[model samples]
Target: MKAEGLKIILSGPSGSGKGTIVRELIKKEHFILSVSATTRLPRQGEQDGVHYFFKTKEEFETMIKDDELLEYAQFCDNYYGTPKTFIEESVKNGKDVILEIEVQGALQVKAIYPEALFVFVMPPTLTELENRLVGRNTETPAVIAQRLARAKEEVAFYKEYDYVVINDSLEEAICDIETIVAAEKLRSSRFKQEIEKVWNA
Candidate 1:
């Protein structure tokens, strides 16, 4: 039997650079980024099943009822979720599935898939995070303040994760996460069959 891939759940505060890290990590070709399902309308240049699996409100509700989704949450009147089938298929095909989500959704996934690798990304400092937010110039001063407040609340939940990496340098953070992934794959439980092979040999 082929060895199944790891189910990785990654979460981080806004401006923590988790997305950037994931983009870079996938360049290695072994990790498969899980596309999320959403009830929101497709934006310009967004393709169905590529950017997201767009669904109607009723379809999303059905998925929730049938447990077809690993985890889901409604945000700003739109529902977003990870489709369980996609992840299962990808892992069975020996592709590590990475799910980048918010803390609440990540916690929900943990309750169900306790074996999954839960990783949390942290900013170098709160002050640095604020600076990054301001540098983006995407939000008003009031909005940036609110995001910083929310970030503090999210940081408190990091204790629940199995691994935490600080994003001081992009390259260093990616290396840290890559090391974590390698270590997890070498865990005793994951090597059970290999152990038996060695013993029999």
Candidate 2:
């Protein structure tokens, strides 16, 4: 069989349930979750190259200049990006690639890889989004407010995605994602050759 893998990009507001949804997908699917690299310090219980590849500012800058990153950005005070090499390797090996990136980086990815599947997970409303952010104790109230403000801008780009999956209930969202995955697998171009082979045989 000629196998092909998709590059799925998930983007949404802070505490808009993107992380939880990604975790659920990883647990239930055969996709490879691509960890992003950052110059920021690792958080509690975060392992090197697992949660993120903690790099020095100089190293990150070098990558930026070398064009070694698929998409790079400065968030808060730290630099973050997806490495170019691993993504290519994962797709070549027929493993689906999942990237949780910001809207700007996701837009850059769309321009570069039009075949990639882009999904925007959205909150029902800004107030509900703020509540979700505040519910997480990891950030300060001020920081949450800042994120909520930026989220409005980010969510505005939801129409650019191939699919819009609302993360209202975690389990229901997972089901929706499963449906998308199953449908993609059956798309004519993805499995037409396999179908022909079966018929010819």
For residues 41-130, write the lDDT of model 1, one tens digit per residue. Answer: 999999998899999999999999999998778899999988999998988888889999889988888898999999999998999999
What tens-digit string does per-residue lDDT give for candidate 2 at 1-201?
656767889998878898888877877546779977899998899999778889999999998999889887799999988888778888888777899888988898998888888999988778888888878778998898789889889888989998998888888887887788767766788777788889989
**lDDT of model 2, residue 69:** 90
TM-score of each: 0.87, 0.76
Q: Give Cα-based local distance difference scores for all models.
A: 0.92, 0.84
Candidate 2 whole-model C-alpha lDDT, 0 to 1: 0.84
Clash count, predicted structure 2 = 0
User: TM-score for model 1?
Assistant: 0.87
List all candidate RMSDs to the true structure.
2.4, 3.7
Instruction: Measure candidate 2: CA RMSD.
Output: 3.7
